[model samples]
Target: MLFYLTTLNLARFLKEDPPFIGEDEIDVQTQQAIDAWKHAEFLCRNYLLNGLSDTLYGVYSVKKTAKELWNSLDHKYKAEDAGAKKFLVGQFLNFKMVDSKNVISQVQELQLIIHGIHAEGMVLSESFQVGAIIEKLPPAWKDFKNYLKHKRKEMSVEDLILRLRVEEDNQGNEKRTLNPNAAKANLMEHDRGSKGKNPKHKQGPKLGPKGGIAKKPKFQGKCFNCGKMGHKSSE
Candidate 1:
């Protein structure tokens, strides 16, 4: 605004208030100046309103001047002093990686906290952030934590997180691949168990009536004509 007003020779209107005796009664000079100021104020209002969310623009839009609107917005978002720094640090300390999402997502959330602290002018070294994240990894990632610690190359936070995301993707693909095979093996075993040995090939008592016949009576044969146990001769 200052730049625009100074370069365009409208600075005086911003510096000194325009005569407000009455819009219709204003002289040509006063009218031109007021018109210029109103135009500039309109542009400024548009700028602020454009940046604000639909819900908040109405609150700051009521300000009478460009400077007041800008200052109000600045104060609303960027709190001055070291107090915000302490708050950001507290957030960083309280952040913990949970197993709710992939390791990459958890790490990204922690990175966001580190970035929030940085945005407050509290600089944290890359290595420090990496170590903090490693320490916060969920219990399931113990082996991965050790693997990262043993790496000879110190990786950037972005690079490490990328690797984590890739590892998670690979793990997911492998699980999908193995699950079908495991299910198939289990199904085959169940089918084999459900089917008994073939009846024709099986070794067991032969099929019979509900109860076997009684033992045959002892055999006795005689010839009636000869009355001989061994033979019968015809007379």
Candidate 2:
């Protein structure tokens, strides 16, 4: 899909009014804009294939609709026509419906396309100084990019701290690696201590004659009936 777009005679399709010449020939910015649109179209195609299972590349159909709609609008209304803009917006929203089932994968791909569109919009808006072209972008696409930028900024301090902590832990672990067997033994010992067992009987303080102050008895007696510890018959 990307190959088809880049290889195709896109300049011919663009139909520049005066026919761009040597210096006016496809500039890098224009090329990037075309590339972004091409990528978006490719993603839209794949999205339709997997989502609708129609096997028809619907992006061309959508573009046809956009072109027809653009032509139908009044020359003065083209830039501000809410109705025409809504048509494009509706198409974008329809494409978004494909995201529900394969959300993670679809979103990942869509995010790339949206980012590309946003970047392209920025270039067009700045390089050509076309506000209307910038406005042509889907509102959701613009919002998504803004949201991503905000989230990135919000995480700056926390991300720095987390990265530093990870680096510190990596250095510390590299300096001293624990033996697996010893680590396993230490874990078992810790577990035993928590289970009311005398893990270090020799090191533990001894019981005294002080009333109720002695270390609790490990066992009272064995039950003859149930064969359980801490129980005795009143014989």
Q: Which lDDT tens digits does candidate 1 get at residues 1-235?
A: 5475467554443334424667577888887877877887666556656767888987877877666666776676666546778777888888777766677767777777788888877898988987898888888778888999998898888788877888788878888887878888898778777885543575655544656654535425576775657554343
Model number with the top TM-score: 1
- Give the per-residue Cα lDDT of candidate 1 at 175: 84
Which numbered prediction scores highest in lDDT against the true structure? 1
Question: Each candidate: what lDDT?
Answer: 0.72, 0.44
lDDT per residue as tens, model 2, 109-169: 4444444545434222232211222233344346533443444333432343354345446
TM-score of each: 0.45, 0.18
Q: Candidate 1 vs. truth: CA RMSD?
A: 9.3
| Steric overlap count per candidate | 0, 0
N/CA/C clash count, model 1: 0
What is the Å distance of residue 1 in model 1 from its true position? 12
Model 2 score (lDDT): 0.44
